[model samples]
Target: MPDYKAPLRDVRFLIDEVFDFAGGYQALGATDASPDMVSAILEEGAKFCEQVLAPLNRSGDEEGCHFDNGVVTTPKGFKEAYAQYVEGGWNGVSADPEYGGQGLPPSLGLLVSEMIGASNCSWGMYPGLTRGAMAAIHAHGTAEQKNAYLPRMTAGTWTGTMCLTEPHCGTDLGIIKTRAVPNADGSYAISGTKIFISAGEHDMSENIIHLVLAKLPDAPAGTKGISLFIVPKFTLDAAGEAGARNAVSCGSIEHKMGIKASATCVMNFDGATGYLIGEANKGLACMFTMMNHARLGTGMQGLCLGETSYQGAVKYARDRLQMRALTGPKAPDKPADPIIVHPDVRRMLLTMKAFNEGNRALAYFTAQLLDVEHLAESAEEREQAANLLAFLTPICKAFMTETGLEATNLGMQVFGGHGFIREWGMEQLVRDCRIAPIYEGTNGIQALDLLGRKVLGSQGKLLMGFTKLVHKLCQEHAEHPQLKAQVAQLAALNKQWGELTQKVGMAAMKNPDEVGAAAVDYLMFSGYITLGYFWLRMALVAQQKLEAGNGEADFYQAKLATADFYFARLLPRAAAHKAAVEAGGESLMRLSAEQFAL
Candidate 1:
């Protein structure tokens, strides 16, 4: 079993030292949560995650969620664990206080998210999706809708899902066949088959509220005509309580590669009781409210999985005796020296550490931006914060997930074949982390969104703004000897990527094909650069703390070393992505229809 202790020191280092969440939240006056309050909440949340959810990880993956006769059953203990989760008031973190939420900063919610996700992603998805659903309703739904649904969702007696994908369509929501018809009672009747709906059907909650995207009868063709609807599994009575069972039913659940414990349902809504959310014929806009939240959360999942895997790997490496050191036998009297004595093994461990710590800093910083965008006093500040996150989200989601996959792979490598086996748990980490990049929109789509929408469409304003932030960080931390070289490297590379983005954007305007061809490559390059910046910031902080005479001198020193490994080994990946993007449309566009055929 993994040590599974909350990386409180590192978490604090990121929240306090790197991003300064308390100060950020205080600036917004969003919450009166003090340092002690934040510490107590994190500690208890970590305890719950480590004790209640961590143990279920392997069991959930092994047993998987079951679907029989239009009903889905989660792995054993999921319901009980979920009860504890709601009881702890976790579902309402950063939610509206008027609706029973804690009204905490998004940063604090992000902290809890990491703990729970690292402990058990499968169990985490249930509440995770519900909170996302609540956010969407709160943001876009009418006052009546909020009154009817927000309280129950905040309380976790009800769960929520985003129902967008169909059997034939995933990313191309414009072509979806789902339909919503208006009723005389002002409710819409939604009839659609939604596939891959996480938390769609589960026994953990009394009702499942689906934020569905469908087209009306007189709607125009494509995405513009679509509308967002809140379709509940059970109809609420006049008293606003879950009452009659609606027409929504789980057709089946997916047999997926990972996250098996979270129910992914194929839902059939035959005239399900539904209400419109936000404007008519603007479903995509409303769905973006939830999708963006899910995107960031998925990235955090990637980061958490990597963190736990690293912790597990470090614990195992120190205890398990392996081959003697290459330099000298550190434990000559014994049969073998611990693997930690070996330089190559140290490299693997360092790689995980560097990626995990950088990801933690990045995730929390992004969360702080979420608070700033919503609660910042000035309109200019809000716009800046929102734009910063807009460009950062795809990078956060794509980059963190991409690094997480690599980090977990390194963790598995550290354990040798033991990591490949089920009993050791590293294998499960890899499996769970793998899905993060694919879902919440594939990293490829994220890349296109970044280059096309985030970068090119806006004439690189958002991208440049984020680049300026990175430049400022580099310049501020320029005096830190340990990080100065890497900081310089990151700044130089970022400038190069920025220049390249401008050139590509200009050329892409003349040729539409170039944008699609370069999207993934551009996204991957940007992701690497973003993570490189994060690693540099973390390295600087680790170096400063190491000089401050911390008792955990060894840990801080190791953090600096890992940051070096990231810049040396991982950041080089940007070269390949850049090369591909610079290839322009020729290579990709040259492939004829017959070339792809047999």
Candidate 2:
């Protein structure tokens, strides 16, 4: 039993004060997006998550997804919950109004996504995958495809999935063996076996659209030869109704350790009726449009998992009576003192809170940049915003996920032995958070993309631009007392990252092996610096609110304390990662074949 509350106050503070969502909405021509409307949406979403989703999390994990023969059944309450979820218009929170969407900001959708993930990540995947698929179709599909698919997808009548990973290939798409043949009827016949497809085949929606990657016959080798095809489980009639059953079938469902509620199907598309999306030879490029969004969404999973675990740990620590404090028992008359009385316990709880809050700020900050990149009017302004957002995307995905796992682990630690038990639900958070680093191109790949393509390719333009934003913020700290130390630490860390990034870039040219050797460490190091910047902004906001003697005094005070803990404990890890990167690539690559055999 975990009682989860969405952090609405903090969300509002970020929306109103930090980034000005109202201004963004107006600039994007969304005049209806008033603060009151946004608040109402979040309140309703919070209720659904806390009441409906949170209660079923443990039960769903216990029940798991049921696969009998070829049909897949989601955990109990999932079907009914999904119906209710769609009825509430939750699926299309940020979709285009022309296609049944509410036309809200993607930032609002992201905020709701955080709550959904916090309550039940397993359940969230069903809709999460659908959104990702919709992004692909909406971006690259033809007008007919948009009319037929986008509406239902927005309404959640049809769920969706991305079929990319196969048994032989997960990251390298060029060598994939799946084939797509052009049919005389202006469609393609797709034949492929896809593995690790989340929400690949589920008995929840009316139809499941799979945007699969397969190579056309007469195509070049590797990534350039791959093409994207929209293959549905049931073929649609001329009127866009479910027509006859298609050849697409589920071979089996993966029996995973976590997210047992969302079915991971091994899909087999045998001569399936398929339509081309975007250009035939340019499939990888089209799919990447969806992947960029997917990567960020996956990162949020870590944040959500961390938030849920933190709430559960806090509830348990307050209720569970245990040994007395080291200095003196806070509850002298009681039979046993609450675990919160111990300094060590406080440290564990504070660590989780600090990381979770910092991550929240990071998600919101990156989301605001997304708004600027998409909606800004001027080309100069848009390019500047896009550059900053692009630079932070990998950091947001890699760092949030890495720290999210750390925060969840801290949550488990706070519960001590109770966390390891199945009944407590702490172990589930740990398991669910573990996959974020592995998915959306393992964190190692993310690092190389950041250092090799984004940083070095631009000759440090993106990195330096981000540095300028930090400098501007630091200059603002002259008037604020609380953020002085945090700002200094961030400045130092950014300088180290800047110098190390330049060195890594230059070394990578001389020997490409050097990039692979230090990619993960560099990614993690940058993640720390970015999150530190977020915490500093949060501390500044919290300090301002507390000074006003607002009603949320305790909440604001807690925010400041957590910010201090992040600077002292978490931000320093980046320095060591930088040192490790500078130690030369030989430490990672110099081992002989015989030595590696052991």
Candidate 1 on 315-428: residue-level lDDT in tens?
889888987888888888889999998888887888777778777877887888888888888999999999999998998898889889988888888899898888898888
State model 1's lDDT.
0.87
Q: Candidates' lDDT values, in order?
A: 0.87, 0.86
Top candidate by lDDT = 1
lDDT of 2 by residue, 234-331 (tens): 99998898889999988898878788888888999899999999998899888887788888898898889988888888899887899887777778
* Candidate 1 local lDDT, residue 293: 94
Off by over 4 Å in 2: none
Minimum summed lDDT over a 10-residue window in model 1 is located at 476-485
Q: 214, model 1: CA deviation in Å? A: 0.8
Minimum summed lDDT over a 10-residue window in model 2 is located at 476-485
